[model samples]
Target chain A: MKTINKFKMQLCAKSTNESFARASVGAFIAQLDPTIEEISDIKTAVSEAVTNCIVHAYKEQNGDIYITVKIFENNKVKIIIRDKGCGIVDIKKAMEPLYTTGGSERAGLGFAVMESFTDKLRVISKVGKGTTVTLFKEIKSK
Target chain B: MECKLNMTDDTLTAELDGEIDHHTAKNVREQIDLEIDTQTPKTLILDFSDITFMDSSGIGLIMGRYKKIKSIGGKVKIKNPSPNTYRVLKLAGMDRLAKIEREE
Candidate 1:
């Protein structure tokens, strides 16, 4: 697929930045003219990935989160969120629904929601190194 | 984010405001739980009429609240979520645990 446009940003992996990540990407992707529903889905997926960086990836230390938004052909969009915090030791188990290690207040549903909202989802991680999450969604023409 | 709570006749209605994410969910959770712990209302109603956005953290917030009230034999009802928020809640299967009223 041919690439159309793209942008990248980095911010502190703080819980307060969750909304910032979602809103920034939402505003940028507004160029694609996504419907309200499609934009909402994109924002929700972005929120989950960014929140994971704050709660799990950077759990032990302060770090930075990098976000890349790219618009590809066929009205498809891809979002990548990366963090240099403690990586997941078990990618398969971690992706399972309701499998959270952050005590009870945390619902292990982060990955589940991201997977459900996006057309495609990918996660890559290495323990003692870092983690990256990618989300893909298609927008309908108005 | 803010949650305005009103209680009468053993029913506590919590009207939520603003966006709900990991950062804001914490404060909302504390406010609602404090009321539930002190008032011990028989029913807890989460009003999403004023909410503009939400994510999975909001799911955790509702689930934790549900567990808190259920242990005391109380019930939870979610009111007036926008269509998009309703979609997120349904993805988490929240509809199975509580009574959710979708906006018409």
Candidate 2:
């Protein structure tokens, strides 16, 4: 697919880096001239996806998290978050709101939040392999 | 994230600043929980006048605190949430669990 602009980053799957991941994505997408609300939506979705990798993917160890942002000519933004850690056993159940494997402390709203904030969301995972999440958003033109 | 807790005879008001994400949510929860556990106040108010950003993690933080305070026969209130933060909070159905006070 042809993209007008693209940026990729690789960060360790650490709890402390979740904000950094979101901030980086937000900064990259700013060039699209998105509204403040649009930016907030993107940042929130990125945070959820990155936090999932840190908390669930690498339960006992650290792994690499790959983030790719692509801006198409149509002013659409696509974000891909990938982690090569313990893949999800059940993607269906995992996307359900309030259904979390991370226990009481986790509200299990990560996937739901991402889905709500973006125009499209796709999750693909394989046990013992990895999980990849793709998100799409149509940036409103000013 | 910056958290400041003010304790009255029966109320605990927490002034939170900066962004609230998964990275900062843990610390925010712990700080507030420590005060809630120690004082067992009759009410807990979260002041968000200075909160610049928040996500679903913020929702979880508030919900968790609501559960804790309710268990102790207390209530939770949110004050001075920015328009964006308030929208997110409402979308999470937090208004049903706690009182969301508009800035005066």
Candidate 3:
């Protein structure tokens, strides 16, 4: 019992692309009648996830990020953000509070905030391979 | 972005316009820190009246400021955050740390 909708977009590993990815996902999912607050939360979570990739993965340089958005009929939205760049070596430690690898002003709260925004969050990574973050939200329609 | 910094006898006010996400948070935090360090105000007021959007990075920025001022025995206050931004701030537990005033 499932109806699925999927969207794929390729973006550069730049800060601006974070907003572009977030806005596109928000506008597309708004067709399902989510509230402004709900949409904003989704966008914020997505932006944080994507920005982590741009900053940590590509080190604020040029690279490609693949974002996939899926909509389920059970009032659920899932976002998968994948990057083919430097990956996290310690997933558990990275998810800890304030454990940042880079010294560039990152508080390491990106994953924490993303976890707080959605119902389910998962990260899969391998060193020198890539990283994929999947976020799930059970929509509370407004 | 246009950042307006105002200084009173004992208070420092910073009005940030535009979005404050990961891209801009570092710069904004640095600028505010420099001003606060130089002025050494007793109280810091952050006016987010014109900010359209923010993310978790903004929360980190605020937290860092809170820590900075707390060490100096000063207080930090936030004003006029948009409803959307307010929701994010609340989610991040900001209302518990600072006095959030809703005014135009």
Candidate 4:
């Protein structure tokens, strides 16, 4: 039996909406019987990616953050976080652990954390265009 | 975010209540550090019993505290962490950095 679900939302690229995005994704994913640890891991990864889009993708001003969630029948969830703002100049440096552009007292471990939590992570960015982060993870079946 | 501090002999316990994310990390760091510096306790206990939600920024906070307490030859431990928080800590390799004890 294969079931599929898709969700989309346009959020403000602000710190406040970051929470909203994370919570929304968390609640949506909670529909599956994911382990408690798995749920937290996904939430944290989603938060980091969304926060990067909120803070760095639109450094100059607030913009729109689009989050698309797709849940497959195999219980694999894919998250696509998109931003229509300033995109990353160097994708490699951005993905590196401890690589942070803002002096906001962060650990610069956002992408690193996201990579660790999900089964797959991909980032597509174009300067002056936008960035989209695709993350995927399969929930453990009970 | 509201942070309450309690001290007992050699242990400094911090009750962190509210959402711990990028926006609240600055003030939370200051308050936690202030308590550690002022009390100079031999062990620091982070009571996350009341925390509702946390993000990667929370990892930064915990890591910063670990560094602070380690520099002073003090140990760090967590108590009553919610299931969600426990997961975040595990993903960040925080369990190895500090000891965790379940609270009943």
Q: Please rank every candidate by TM-score, starting with the best.
A: 1, 2, 3, 4
In the order shown, the candidates' DockQ scores are 0.85, 0.68, 0.48, 0.41
Q: Candidate 4 chain A: minimum summed lDDT over ten consecutive residues — where? A: A98-107
Report the TM-score of candidate 3, chain A only. 0.94
- Candidate 4 at B87: error in angstroms? 4.7
For model 2, residues B25-53, the per-residue Cα lDDT tens digits are 88989999999999999999999999998
Q: Pick by DockQ: which candidate is best?
A: 1
> Which residue segments of model 4 deviate by more than 4 Å?
A1-3, B69-75, B80-87, B95-97, B102-104
User: Residue A34 deviation, candidate 4, in Å?
Assistant: 3.4
Candidate 3: give the clashing pairs. none
lDDT of 1 by residue, A1-142 (tens): 8889999999998888889999999999999898999899999999989989988988835899999999999889999999988999999999999999887888889999899888999999999888999999988899
List the TM values for chain B, per candidate: 0.97, 0.97, 0.95, 0.93
Q: Candidate 4, B35: how far from true, in Å?
A: 2.9
Superposed Cα deviation of residue A13, candidate 1 (Å): 0.6
Q: Which stretches of candidate 3 lie over 4 Å from their true place?
A: A1-4, B90-97
Give the Å shift of residue B59 in candidate 3: 1.9
- Predictions in order: lDDT: 0.92, 0.91, 0.85, 0.85
Residue B42's lDDT in candidate 3: 88
Shift in Å, residue A89, candidate 1: 0.9
Error of 3 at B62 (Å): 1.5
Residue-level error in angstroms, candidate 2, position B54: 1.3
lDDT of candidate 4 at residue A5, scale 0 to 100: 90
lDDT for model 3: 0.85
